[model samples]
Target: MHIVAVGLNYRKAPVDIREKFTFSDESLPVALQQLKRTKSILECVILSTCNRTEIYAVVDQQQVCGHYIRSFLANWFQIEIGEFADYLTIYEDNEAIRHLFSVTAGLDSMVIGETQILGQVRNAFLLAQKHNATGTLFNMLFKQAITMAKKAHSETSIGENPVSVSYAAVELGKKIYGNFKNKNVMIIGAGKMSELTLKHLHANGVGKIVVANRTLQKAKELAGQFAGTFCSMGQLEEMLVEQDIDIVISSTGADGYVLTLEQMEPVMKKRKSKPLFMIDIAVPRDLDPRLMDMPNVYLYDIDDLEGIVESNLEQRKREAMKVDKLIEHELEMFHQWYRLLGVGPVIGALQEKANRIHQETMSNMLQKLPDLTEREIKVIRKLSKSMLTQMLHDPIMRIKELSAGRRGVEELDLIRELFALEDMLKEQARLPKDFLLESKPSESDDDRISPVNPVLA
Candidate 1:
């Protein structure tokens, strides 16, 4: 069996390209089912988010599964392969495991150390489990990754700082007001960025929120999330002046300033020189820079927040080093489990082969000594079985140890060849209905051995 991951992420694909491949919640189940239906794919999971769309699968080694995965994506999304293939990245086996671990740990995020991605990863895994898209390997792998992520967060400072721009904006707010509970906030737009900033503010217990946007419905929808008021863009100036808003967060798409000094001066004066903290996260500069010159007014732009984000990221990077060590340790544990899985059929085959030889030899000896009593025959059979077990114990232990090492798979292959256990192992797949009750292999069964079972050669 081979583990593979095929996807395009924020690092390799632009937003336009990434958006093209995004799988909505409604579409995810369909996509997962379709992917798993492919001939090479045995087990599958799909993780789709704003920044990436990744597919993880356990597949047959007889064919190049990566090619089939890419083709599946193209056909499912109705896009030409050449359109986004250049941006896709493929990781096989250990690399795929590492990629998933890094992603779950938030090391692969655009904002390093952000906690949201961990939740997103968990949700993706749960969705896959709910749809039955993930089988034994993914079930174990994803659970391990989540456990490691939890440990990383609890044992390290990786998720302790604010690394996102929205978070940095909140940090700035906290610095000025010392607390958000008493500060009234006015959001100048209802876009995703505004919603994110508002989420941070609400988490900090900010006072009443007022959302103003070009579309009153969008403003109301966003405001409803925080139990805040909503108003049209035309009412922004009036609301700002009348409500005595203390913090103004603007993230509008307007080409010009959304809040100019000319518009905010009177609002500031109406409050009798009360402090006003403004953050302009918009690209075209939502607030006039001249607003900074006004008394009791502090205005910061996107560039100002970037400096804090950079500093926070530097701290996160230091914490990430500790996370990397944790991941390394966890990876080895998973590899051990994986190797044990690979050696299971080998161990079963070896024991079966030994038991068969013991039974045959005992039968032949008994036939030549028909005068032996039933009790004596039973004694001989027991002694011979015990001796055979003792004889095979050391070699079995050695093979298990070797299988859990670097060249484990190679060692298992050698064991299968030396013991001539390949056919015996293959026969296991075709056992009769009462095979579990039967003492020996059946000759009539024709089922092929699972490719994942290493002893099948």
Candidate 2:
């Protein structure tokens, strides 16, 4: 199988395009079923989120699969190939496998250690599994990928940091205040990050939420979703003073700081020095960085939250080395399985050899012993079949174990060379019932990272 991952992500596509590809919970099933209808695709899974829209497929002919899938995306999003290709990225074979592993491990996520993507991956795989759109290759690949992601989280300190700049701000709040269950949150700015962080704060159990944007209508629209208060920038300071916000997450698109230390200094004095967690995720930084040094004022600029994001990213990178080793081990195991995938052909040749010999012997004996009773002939046939099974049992068992991946591919390859399987197939005219039992066993695109590429059909 030629495993391929083709899609666009937050890194490659803007929010509008990304949102265009986002799979709503209501529509994933239909899209997944549609993906399977394309030719060359033996199995498929679609993972769509706000940040990415990726398809994982096992195909017979890669060029065919790639074309159909790309065209499908163009049609679905109503964009030309040239127009859309600018935002798309593709990975074939082992690069595809590595990408899947990295994604599940949180290395490729927008948030380095956020636990959400893992759930999304699981949900996508499960959706495919439900439709029987997944085969052995994908089932094994996805299952193992999930396990590796968990290992990355459990075995490292990568999950110790925030995943997004907005989330980093919330994390800074949690670090200082422990829980957000009873705290009020006023999400400043109407940008998408601000919207997403507002959702995160709600999900994290913030008691009350307030949306304050430059446009009161946008704020009102967003406030409707979270059931929060809405206000305009004209009323910014007044709203800030009136609401008693415990946390401020700002992503306002402004040329300069929206909240200065002088403005906030009096606000703090008006209220009795209540600790405030102010996170400015705006590019120009909505809050003054100098305000961080003030008492009862915990302010973080975009650079500071992003600094945490970078350090956390480095930590995730360090932890990913361990996941890499795990994938390495699994890759070796898969190679062995691939070698063993040839077991069906081996056993077929062997069984045919035995049966042919048995048939010839019986034919000649039956002509010679014309007076032989029917019972006697039947007994001879039964005896010959018993001998065949007993003679082949041990070797067949060993070859099968090798095929099932218990034996390494190199060792299995040695067995194939020893048995001269290519020559055997040429010599044998007919194969038995078990000839292709596993039907393309080593057909996994996710092979080990090695000096050699998988011997593709």
Candidate 3:
């Protein structure tokens, strides 16, 4: 099967168009199942975030697969085909496969070397699995992709910076507070972004954390896991007063400001102007934009983060040169395995022709010399099969070696030409008069490696 990717991402589509395609946490399983149900698909994953929406699927027919996926996506988002189609992009075969590996390695991310994408990809794969929307092809593809990501992180400096928007909030916290060891941080939402930000904080040994959300159950559930305090929205103002919260990272999905300048005035007063660092890491921001004008208050909206994140991006680009070789080497290894898969049918045809010749001669001899040499005839047949196997051994081994290096796909077509394999099966009709073709070739059941993922383990 061929690898195919179709979707619009941050580079090509504006926020409005992207938001329309964003899949909430609840929609992934259904989306995965829907994609897998399309024609020629063997596996599927849907990655939808505020910045981008992409689908990775393994399919057989590119013509049908591309249109089916595009149509499915357009229908799901309730967009007219002609209107939205222009915003979508599709990459097929090698281009699609390479893009996936590159993306997992942070090569194609908006933030040049973001590490969060690996986790995002893993989540998509898990969701696909949950819905039984995957098979062997995807199991191998994703495993390799994850492995590639790990290698990129360990061997390269790409993941050295937190390129994701969630972690950008942590960077902002660090800049404002200098040290989080003495800070009481309050996270306003219990979403994935909030959880990731908490992880970064926990690693840095933040003083304490508190979860204040609209739902007490969610607040308690999330807070308990992070060893933090929790309170419902009714107790938000009181919680803010009690914690002496040094930094506020708010990102709830509220329609308007969750907190206004006037609302935080009294809370700030109680702290004696402790320089509250507030980060509105949300769209339709969780706080009033005017809150920044308050004395001793450092409020950084998302725009302020771009500068810090950009510096981090610059550092990643400098270190990327070091990791470049590692990625190239890994891609070469994967390429080799893919090329080796093309030899299967050619080898099968060779063995089929040899076995048929042996069978026909055996039947003729057995009939012609019925009693003269029954034992001798059996010995000759065994010798003939053994000789044929030995003759074919060199070509098979060479085919494998040629398929094992960089850009091995280039060698597959050449191998097919050199061996005259396109016509090998046609020669089957030239069998001797007494020859009887076997019901099934002896090697027909041998293991085959498909080029998409020749091997994973």
Candidate 4:
């Protein structure tokens, strides 16, 4: 069978397009079952997140797998093929494996090195497994992917740095105070940026939060979300001086600077020159630039935070190189297992045929020489089976080695031809019942590793 992945991510499609293809958690089991019933899909998993939606499948035909998956999406989501065809990207076999590994490791995420994608992949695999939509191949492949991601995170610093603007603000705070614990924060706006910054601060266990906005109701609404207190723009000066605010994040839509150096000078003096941190995230510059030059005043603008984000992004890129090497190693291991799967049925059929011939020969010799003692017949049967097993052992080992190497699918056919097992394979019922050619190959099946040689033991 062939492995295939077909999907559109944030890089390939906009939010609107990606959202249209998402699968709700409640619908995933039914969706997976339906996808598995498609002509080429034997096993399937759907990974649907806000940024991307993808389907990974094991299929009977590589050529038709993509078309069938697209059709499945079109029918299930009620979207036209033409509507999303341009956004779709399909990877087959090794490429499919590589893509999954990269995605699970967060290399393919819109935000590189983000850990959320790894959990999403794990959830997708688990959901598929719970629904019986995944078999041996996917079970192994996805487990490896999840394990690799965990390894990447633990072994590298890929996720250690902050890459978003709001996060950068927090990281800068860390540089000055190590952490925000027991520090009061005053957020100067009711905008989305202000809310996000407040969230990061609240999560860091800041002592107290005060939201200040020109509109008192808007400030109250934003503060209520985080269990923070609110103050009108007119009370900004009084709140700073009275509350001993340690951090000030300003992102107002006003045209002029909200806090000037002159305004903060008296406040800093009144607070006994205590350090004050401020972040100006507004487009028109809410916090005064000259305030940064004042003693005990730590101030940063959008440009400064963006620079930190860019630097952090570069650091993540460097770490991703290490993850790539890990991915390469996992891909090799997966291919090794896959190669053995291809040769398993052929080897099983060969052993089954050899046993049939050995049984017939032994029975005929025993019947022809009935005068021989029972002990003699038993000895002869044991010796005959041993000889056959000894002869098959070396060849079986060599075949396994070749299959696990760079040998292609055509080599399996050649091996079958040499053993004259072609006819036996065609007679499906006569083939060994243990050798399930269409289903997943068992790793514990002796024939997969040693063929008829195990009979000697």
Candidate 5:
């Protein structure tokens, strides 16, 4: 069996292409079940967020796993493979494992060392397990990934300096309006990113915060967290016209532009050319692009924050070197676990054959000497058992050592041939179920960390 990951991220695909492949919260379980049922796919998990969508799976066929995953995406998302095939990236075996570890460790995020991706990874793994989409392989792999991420964050200061798209947006606003104490901020979303932006603004001492959402209650709740006021989506245009809203931060799930050029033209006109600085962090972009062309209107989308993100990354990059070391350690542990799956049954079968031969030989001898005392017979049995154990101990130890190296499977095959254990080995087939039953609980379980709410990017 092989571990494989196929997907696109912010580095490989733009937000427009990335948004097309996203699996909504309501659609994730169904998509997972469907993918699990696909040919060659044994176990699966889907991780979808604003920036990326990744599918991790254990498959019987290494060469064709990517094709199957792409096919699954096409069927699930109802788009042709050509539409996204070029954007998709595939990794197998060790590369797949390393990618997952790096992603969880925050080394692969657009904002390096961001803590939110850790929680996102944990949520995806848990949801997959809950819906029975994961088996032995994924349960171990994902738990290890989560444990590694926690270690990376705790041991290093990668996430120490709070830098995110939201934080960057606030900084950009400060450039236009130096003193936020008198600047009125309007955040047009109730999601986590919007709340985070509001938090940054609150820290900067912004005045008159208003959160607008499709649902007034959610808007009210988010606004209440920052001691700000709320308004409904219907009231958004009215508030833009009536209030002296200096800066606007918009992040929403709308399919199209929430603030269109036609809608904003009149609002901008009413302001009589008062400069309105806007930041749109949504994937489908809540604010219209044409709004940027208007006089005295400055609009920045998610991609615009990259420059700000880059400038503040030197210190985090230094810390990320520490995270890379942690990933290497975790990767070795995963490899060792994988090796055990290959050799465990071989060792069991070898020992079983040795014990069988010892028992049969003793049974025939005892029958030939029927007059022997019960005590003598017991002594003979005990001595012969000890001799059999002693004879096999060295070979067993050697087998374990060989299994940890590069040519493990080849060396194991030779051992199986010598013992005439081909039939027994064939019956095992290296399926995840057999190993799960034979294996001990992973060390990660004892050290598993709770999911954390991200304070930074």
Candidate 6:
């Protein structure tokens, strides 16, 4: 058996092409059923997110399975094969395993080191499991991937800092005050930037948001979204003093300063030295730069937030190296387990072949020794079984050890040829009963394990 991953991701496909292949939550089960119904695909999982849509499957033939998967995708999504074929990527075996590990570790995310992809990966596996689309191989692989992802997050600082400007502002707020649950937030504008910043703050449990804008209607509209209070820009000072707002996010479209040093110095004094955090996301700067020098007041402008974001991104990149090494370690461990799977069918076939020969010889001996007692016959049978096991022990152990390395399939084939167990091995090598019925590859196709390359036209 071989593992294969065929799909297009953010790196290879544009949003339009990626969206075309994306599977909806309601359609995922049906899609999985359709893929597994194909002759080549044995087991499968579909991972669809805003950035990528991937299909990971265990297949009987890697060489032709890519064609089968591509055909399935084109037919299912009702797209022309020529239209999106160039965007597809195919990975088999080790490459497939590494791709999955990287995805679960968040290394494949649009934003590196983001933790959301880890949960997304887990959800995809669970969805596949729910539909009975996965078996022993995928079950173990996905579980190990998730465990490795958790280890990456806990052991390294990949998800420690924020890499986006909006999130950086929130991170800065977190540094000043550990939690936002009790703090009041004051927004100086009702633009998209302010709304986005407010959204992050709200997510972090900020309380009692006050929206102040030149247009009272827009302020009220934005404030209504968060169930917070609204006010006109004229009452900004009163709201600053009376509302006890701890964080001020200003993004007004005014050339002049909205909150000058002269205006905030008195408000700072009235608040009895309470610490204030301000984020100014305006081009000309809404909050006066001089306000940063004021006692108990911390201010960050657009450039400042961008600097923090850049620095955090660098830190995440550094942490990603640690995650990469962790993935390599986990991949080796998973490969060891996967290699052992090949040994089982081969060993089973060998045992079956030997038992047949032993039974044939014993039947002929029993005919010759008709006077032998039934108890003596039983003793002879037990001795024959014990000798067979002892004789095969060393060879079986060597086959298992060799199977864990690169020449596993070659060695197994040699063993089958040597024991004249070709037919027996073929029966044992058939896809498991639980798997969907599929056409087996011909003898000539057995050695054709190479994957189809994406048409980069």
**In terms of TM-score, how similar is model 5 to the real structure?**
0.89
Output the number of the TM-score-best candidate.
5
Per-residue C-alpha lDDT of model 2 across residues 74-156, encoded as one tens digit per residue: 87767788877888889897788888888887777766766668887998999999998898788988998888788777877
Each candidate: RMSD to true structure?
A: 8.1, 11.0, 7.0, 10.7, 7.5, 13.0
**lDDT for each candidate structure:** 0.82, 0.74, 0.74, 0.81, 0.84, 0.81
Give lDDT tens digits, candidate 6, residues 1-457: 8999889986788654665676767888899888889987788999886567899999998789988998999899899999998999989999999999999988877556777678788999998898889999999999999999999989999988755445767777887789998899998989776787788888899988999999999999999999999999889888988999999988776657899999988898999998888987664567888998999999887555534556668888899999999999999888777767667767767766767667777789889999999899878877876777677777777778787777767877787788787798677668586442465655423222222111110
lDDT of 1 by residue, 191-222 (tens): 87789899999999999899999999999999
Q: Candidate 6 has which clashing residue pairs, if any?
A: none
Question: In candidate 3, what are the lDDT values of residues 213-312, reduced to their tens digit?
Answer: 8888888888888899998776766777788888889877665678888888887888777778888776546777788899988887755565577777
Cα lDDT tens digits, model 4, 412-434, are 77888889987877775565766
Estimate TM-scores for all models: 0.73, 0.62, 0.72, 0.68, 0.89, 0.64
Q: Which scores better on lDDT, 4 or 5?
A: 5
- RMSD value for candidate 4: 10.7
Q: Cα lDDT for residue 203, model 4?
A: 79
- Runs in model 2 deviating more than 4 A are 162-166, 169-184, 187-208, 211-308, 345-349, 356-360, 372-457
Tell me how candidate 6 scores on lDDT.
0.81
Clashes of each: 0, 2, 1, 0, 0, 0
Quote the positional error of residue 346 for candidate 3 in Å: 2.8
Ten contiguous residues with the weakest lDDT in model 6? 448-457
- After superposition, candidate 4 runs with Cα above 4 Å error: 164-199, 203-308, 423-457
lDDT of 4: 0.81
